[model samples]
Target chain A: MSAVERIPILKIGDVLLASIQVDLQDRDVLALQEDLAEKITATGAHGVVLDISAVDIVDSFIGRMFATIAATSRLFDAHTVVVGMRPAVAITLVELGLTLGEVRTALDLEKGLAILAELGERAPR
Target chain B: MTAAREDIPIAADEDVVRVRQIVRSFAQRAKLSLVDQTKLVTATSELARNTLTYGGGGAAVVELLGEGRRQGVRASFQDSGPGIPDTALALTDGWTSGRGMGLGLSGARRLVDEFDLDTEVGRGTTVTVVKWSR
Candidate 1:
């Protein structure tokens, strides 16, 4: 049996990068999501960049997890941005009525980095 | 082996690909439209995964329906695991029992034209969804 992998966290300058490499299946996604959120809060970074490019689909569980991360980041005074959402996954998210207004989204990692920089500039130290 | 006309029972461990193949085969035999075929297949895949996760494993029934002049496809997922205690709460968005995001049932309902769910505590649960081609 293959072992379940946890998400990886990287601290680069003021940006805390959280990368997810799992299949995001029905099982084991919630625990991974909660762990990522807690890690973001504990890091106390200026902003968070979540890279989900490897994930082909963003089901309701993952989507809700993104929302939770965004909400929790606000409490920690850090902004969260989601990066690398595939077109099909985006359409599915829209059809499912997931509100991603509060959480910023970028087309790629570079765009996400730009957003994180902008968010840091706006936030007071 | 000749494909049977009766319902096909699938194990819970099957992935989305197998579920899609089963749905497509049934829809093709029924001569359903490509659009309806895709929708039904996607919805069935979602529900099948839910059954395995929350119900601890279950079987899906794929049937070709013909009611006089109208022809359609109907698929039902039945599980012997713990039945949903609160149907309304289960249907609500973001209310997931296991690791799901709680959109399987609601999303399945939206994909099909006709959806029916019946469940009883300690008994089990059955979800039947139908899509017609005019």
Candidate 2:
């Protein structure tokens, strides 16, 4: 068994960037969901960029985790953007009939931050 | 060279993760492309989850195959639990008896090069799949 790993959540400006760099266990993902929600409230962040660029695959459980995070972030009025999904993962997600539940998607982390910025600018403060 | 076979237990969530990591190393050692590796690992993850959640825990057998110019990997998930009453319906997209998207079986079929399912009510169930190197 591997040691517990916590995905880091970095705050940049008003956007929170969370990059999933390791192959997360189910418990790690569940822990992350809880951690991210708390971070949003603690930091008062407005947007979240979840960069999964290094992720090679996503089962339905992980897919549901992303949706839950996005939905929870919405409760705090924080926009969530998923970034860097590989082509094969995308295809598999579609086959799984998981649209990621209305979570926004971008091609890369740069674009993800850009989208979050745009979302931040358009919303009324 | 013929590859060795391994049997991994899928008794819990951590076991499922363990299976994924083991299959990943196997895929890498088999020289499967990144895309193929991802697909195989993803499919194995889903099946392992099913074995744990629905099958009351089971075992996954991983095998590496090479015959002449053809080479690939095969994984079989076996469970001794209440079998699916309707295999066809279970294979249908968007159909699930439990709380899930029901993509575990059908979606896994799409990712692999070959798929075989064996089940008997009150007996057990086994799903065997193979991914040919591409």
lDDT of 2 by residue, B17-116 (tens): 8889878877877778888888889889989888888899999999888867767889999999998889999898888777457788998998889999
Lowest lDDT sum, 10 consecutive residues, model 1 chain A, at A22-31
The per-model DockQ list reads 0.17, 0.57
In angstroms, the error of model 1 at B99 is: 6.8
Candidate 2 residue-wise lDDT, A64-110, digit = tens: 88889999999998999999999978876775566788699999989
lDDT of 1 at A19: 79
Record all residue pairs in model 2 with backbone atoms less than 3 Å apart, i.e. clashing.
Answer: none
Model 1 misplacement above 4 A: B1-49, B52-56, B60-76, B82-102, B112-122, B129-134
Best by DockQ: 2
lDDT of 1 by residue, A1-125 (tens): 23445667788887788777755443455566576567766767878888988765565556767887788777878888999987656765666656774899999989999998887888668
What is candidate 2's TM-score against the reference? 0.91
Residue lDDT tens for model 1, B42-62: 678778777777777777777
**Model 2 chain A weakest 10-residue run by lDDT:** A91-100
Best by lDDT: 2
